[model samples]
Target chain A: MVNVLIDGLKERISNAIKINQSIGIILPASNYPDLVQALFERINSTPEEAWVYVTVTKPCDNILSQFEFLKDSKNIKFVDCISRAAGINKANDNCIFVESPTMLEKIGLEIINIFKEVDENVKKYLVIDSLTNLIIYNDPDIVTEFFYHIINRTRTKNIHTISLAIEEEELDKYLTRLIYLNDKILKVRDSFI
Target chain B: MPITELSKNELCDTGIEELDVMLGGGIPTGSTVLVVGSSGSGKTTLCMQYLINGAKKGERGVFFTITEPLFKLTKNMEGFEFYDKKLIESGMVNLIDLRIISERLGLDTEKYTVEDASALLDILRDIADELNVKRLVIDSITALCYRLQTPEMIRDFIFKLGSSLAAMKCTTLLTSEVPPRKFQYSQYGIEEFISDGIMFLGDIERKGDLIRTFQLVKMRGAAHSRTKSAMSISTKNGVELAPLLKSRE
Candidate 1:
């Protein structure tokens, strides 16, 4: 049977892909992997949109290895904020690594720089792998405020954003603000594998 | 100044594509660049590649070895594809062991005065002029600077030699090192000041992996990135680069 949650996200993405569009995804703990896969598959098929994936939970290598197809995709870039701090000092050519997740400002600059670098004709998408991971490393209030600016900033550049949050992670304070900043909220309730 | 004005000064490419990108095309012609690194951080490999690349461009080059002999250096170079025997045999690239030069000059290795340093500089300048080379590398300027024994003499000698080489249009790379845990680019903290450019090859110890890194710390008269990149040297690739990952706790 087709996954209802996956179908829901795919259906919602069409309208959410417009300029200034921001979709906040709230995922169930066990269904995180399936929903992200579904989301990227939708993105991968869309030829005009180039993705800039910002990961705070995992390094770029881990993500690229898990999503092996991404290795061949030149349409995507990564902003990994984890690897060297974990004692792994390597990075792929397509990915840019921020020194630490704590370096929030640097992360912001790198994200903007990547967006600036992507082809101008291609539509841009900024996907925060998960925002809760950032709250764990930073103060909730500040991360929310900073992301508020990120959403607005990217919107002006004709870029859409999809910020994910895991319900398994109890970051109630920040999640509430995340919802307010987003134009639409999505709940991925796909049954956990 | 007119908006259309541009510099016509010549530039010397390092032949390392990524490095040349970081250097804003290339180092200015007749510049002195310091290649500082800790031991085993691929300083020699980088310098060797630079000279070999120059030779491929038909611009003759010379390498003055201060830390090792000519024979051993060539033996190590054999492992890298950049090491071309034809260039060395044809005198397109010359490797001169500094120890032999010292022996010829009759200067005491342990103690070298400012006058002795001047004499050494004159001899090197003569050799560089004689060869009519476009590129020159002094592997481990620290070892040679140690002989000078004082900051003033080292500074004086570097300045004099750099000025003289500039006149002859010989782009130079001088190797030096920094101790572990210390931030200074050079051993004596003075070589960095005199050199026209500073490229530091550093290593980070993480989880038993010695991660080599490259940073173009200073490149005068050039637009360069301040970001650090992960670096590696291999027999097939010579020197390769990748993005440096973020650190973890």
Candidate 2:
């Protein structure tokens, strides 16, 4: 497993991964760019781990452009849900395109298939780019239910999963329930290195 | 200038006196207003009141329910003083249940095609023409958007629906589910842009108590208060808008 790039947070994050495979992170929307950069840096450091990045907010091309270094990595897989939803049909050999974020079943099935295809020698990780965007397209209860299923399935498969969400003053009841379902909750601060 | 007088013919009363006052009279005639709020925020009650007000004034009204069944809706409204069963029985107030139609048409999909939108538009037009509906309400448009696959489809549906309603000169109110976000105007965020007016209902926590607040975000051509006012509901009066709260800033 690759350690996060943040100074003090690296050890804590690694410890959380050891204690519990599934983790949920809450942070201000403004901090998402920094977090994503740090996350990709960590993923790039680890050669044996294969990652499936499920993006609900941005298109695969946009995400790839930000972390261009990871584009050539064989261990990185992209599940582009935004492109098909936006009516773009561009095909990429390295990415799987889902129709839309509302098609939770399709996304879940794709994740399962990816897990099956990867060899046992490679460690697997699933990163849901965002839960906030998912809730915007679907009902809160429905999104929460989908997360429950995905988290439980990933845990059973021994595949590490990370879900990200924006912090709100009053946490949504459904999202609060989702946080409880996860093994650990990490609050990402804007000042974190 | 003296308080500008509003022509009674140009405004449609919202059934709530205080709300009408806050709206600079009622909403302009033939305008589409988006009523946005979270669950249990009295969105349905406001829609029901709008239709009941029209029925009481001898104007024909139609309510298209996409989320709940007609029977359950009527049963739940039994406690409201304005919910008269006779209005529906007399055909003055028509309830077109779209839930059954949605199920049959398999409306739940990744994307709602143009054909699907046309089919829905046809049904709405037919009912509007047959009933000569002067007032119209879609219990909730949020549920409809969930079935439609893309943001474009949802936007197209709202545009067509608004245009059609305006052609009939029918005052329409569409309810939208407000997401958990504190600042969201509507579910997909496009509803407020397409609507002629937007009304927001939400609760504020003060000393651990939830105080319901109502605000008129904007009204295209009318003069209205922008301040957030306290709100309450009762069986006798469906919705009441109180004085605006002091600005937190």
Candidate 3:
């Protein structure tokens, strides 16, 4: 599987670029901006085309604006994966939903459903805003099983998914297992400024 | 601080030479220490070291595991030089196996009640007392915290557990996986306040090198090393902490 290392702030962003996969940033809640920057810069480093999906739980913040910048960047297509669907309408494009710690299980299943809606013929990559919110909002058993399901679908359907989470004391082993299922894993660590 | 009949000499060693030295020879006898860290940061290994050290000294040790089965637990530590399987078999070090407890509770077994914390606490207390456990380890307070789901409840349970251990006059180590970045304020915030002591293990990368470090954030009535020290886990040594350093590199 995948070998992951929790790296320093500078190294963290670069490591994300090196792996060139969806990354999981495990830090304190306040460090979300640093992690988002790390991901954004990593995405910008590549000359190749990329379709970046920014799905957040809470309302728009600075990271949302950063996504707007990527919209003008060469070879990058951004999609909002959060759904505002009533039941299970997977085909709606503008009907997006936001991710929040309170809605981890709900949004998780929605993201999975969205993946199900995508045409199998197209190559797609999914970046989960974070795995920590999932851990904070849901039990590890549920989150692990949820990630397992996502990994299974990604592999069987050739979809690449990068999930992020802030590292907490006991959840690393579980995170390691989830990363093991992925093609590659990148971990970020930050030095408080 | 007022002196008590219990002295620091009665505490069990952690098997880490530098750490024991830093802890004023060992953890304070009959006190609780919360061990917090990020995922894969060696929280369990620290607990294992504490228990194995106790077992080696002819004192009883108890491990209450929440997530892994006994085989996997044993297998994972099989490579660690200090894992004393003999001690395990001889009952010097006992694993309560919360996985089994949860499984039984799922099957509606009368032995375990998933509905209440009091029942779980009672069962745990019974086990600790029956063994005359000198050192008690709860693999994680997080699993219980996740199920319980309230800071207030967690606060009460943690305080109660700490008090129970103090009453039993047994030293305890409770593991909690707190994101180093987010929960640094208290590791889970209020937990450090409830527990007798707080020990933190962090895996940090510096200048392209991944380093494992540890520190004693707070201890109620004991003299402890204040330095953030280096630590490591390998086949030869399960969890080894170095002498406390002056600063984080």
Candidate 4:
């Protein structure tokens, strides 16, 4: 599975990128962090291209360290809803730590705000680290509504968005809706189907 | 609702520049304006700013806290530079916890009887009269209504309180809470009818962002913009209003 993911990710993403910019990736719950690193690595982000990472699962520091390419970029920013909510209370320069993951409005505002620093003409990307954790903090309806709103908004702004989600049987409804919301889909594991 | 007949009545400017524009000068003096919103929708901040702004204009403003304590309310206000301590010290702005007033009047009950509600209303009137207050804000009408028990009692209490304060020419703002994304303005469904004006402070989803919104739904005395506008609150500026994004296009 690991070999299949790492090798096929770039080619699969490149093929999909040509057809559609808004893509959803469904990963097995086994090891998405490594899968996430691989996905980010495969994209081969550039300094000129603006990136906004919305992380609900891991700290911004952990996410930064995992992807060494992300470390050197001055253009990349983060919407870290977990750090302060977890009682770390520590602040990062480019990161906007939302009061709680439940404050979806504030998180969306921060994402929109940070992206303001980049020129409108710049190639912008919004990568939601994982929605599986976001669902835990918010109700199902709210979670779905948020993505429905964000994806629609980002499309108008000409921003490429990649939302990562862990495929689980219990959350099949949420996963299915998420897949339908995006223009492209890359399913790493499809046990539910 | 086309209300083309504008108020020739005196205006009590809310001190928010854009809001004043939205309100067509400001709230008509001696009118009871309901500021309704869900939690974190900037209702308290808007109320505090109105009071502070009134104080700046040499109009005595009194804020009665119904749910949160006066200390916590003040502590929250501590960040706002507009909330001056001098206003409190010089007796221009007064922050009174309603519990103390209720206790003093012996009407502090788990659920107020009709007579208790009347007495409480009278007590608030006396406070407004004594202070020579030009602006008044009850931190919430919801919590106060919860103690009123019945809808009839809540209506009676609000109706009396609004008229009495209006008679004193006290431009009042009564904060109200509704669950987020819900259209139910007043929990009792009666405060809207009794109040002279209704200013809804709610959230509107614009691109995954729950933008705080202010809509002057129905102001009986003024011709104002009835559309929902985006709102933001900060320590520097208590409440700032901007035009809302209507759609993605």
Instruction: Predict model 2's lDDT versus the native.
Output: 0.78
> Which residue window of length 10 is worst by lDDT in model 1 chain B?
B1-10
- Candidate scoring better on TM-score of 3 and 4: 4
DockQ of each: 0.04, 0.01, 0.01, 0.04
TM-score of 3: 0.52
Clashes of each: 5, 3, 23, 0
RMSD for all candidates, in order, please.
7.5, 20.1, 19.2, 8.4
Model 2 ranges with Cα > 4 A deviation: A1-193, B1-6, B102-111, B245-249
Per-candidate Cα lDDT values, in order, are: 0.78, 0.78, 0.63, 0.78
What candidate 1 gets wrong by more than 4 Å, as runs, is: A18-31, A43-128, A134-163, A167-193, B1-8, B11-28, B34-65, B68-123, B130-132, B148-156, B180-185, B196-249
Q: What is candidate 1's lDDT per residue for A137-157, written digit by digit as tens?
A: 766765776687788788788
lDDT per residue (tens digit) for residues A1-193 in model 4:
6566555666666577557878988888875755676656654555667789899988887777777777666877888988876787766776777666766655666677677678988888898877777776666676787788788878888888888888778887877786678998888753322
DockQ agreement of candidate 4 with the native complex: 0.04
Better of 2 and 4 by TM-score: 4
Against the native chain B, what TM-score does each candidate's chain B reach? Answer: 0.92, 0.90, 0.87, 0.92
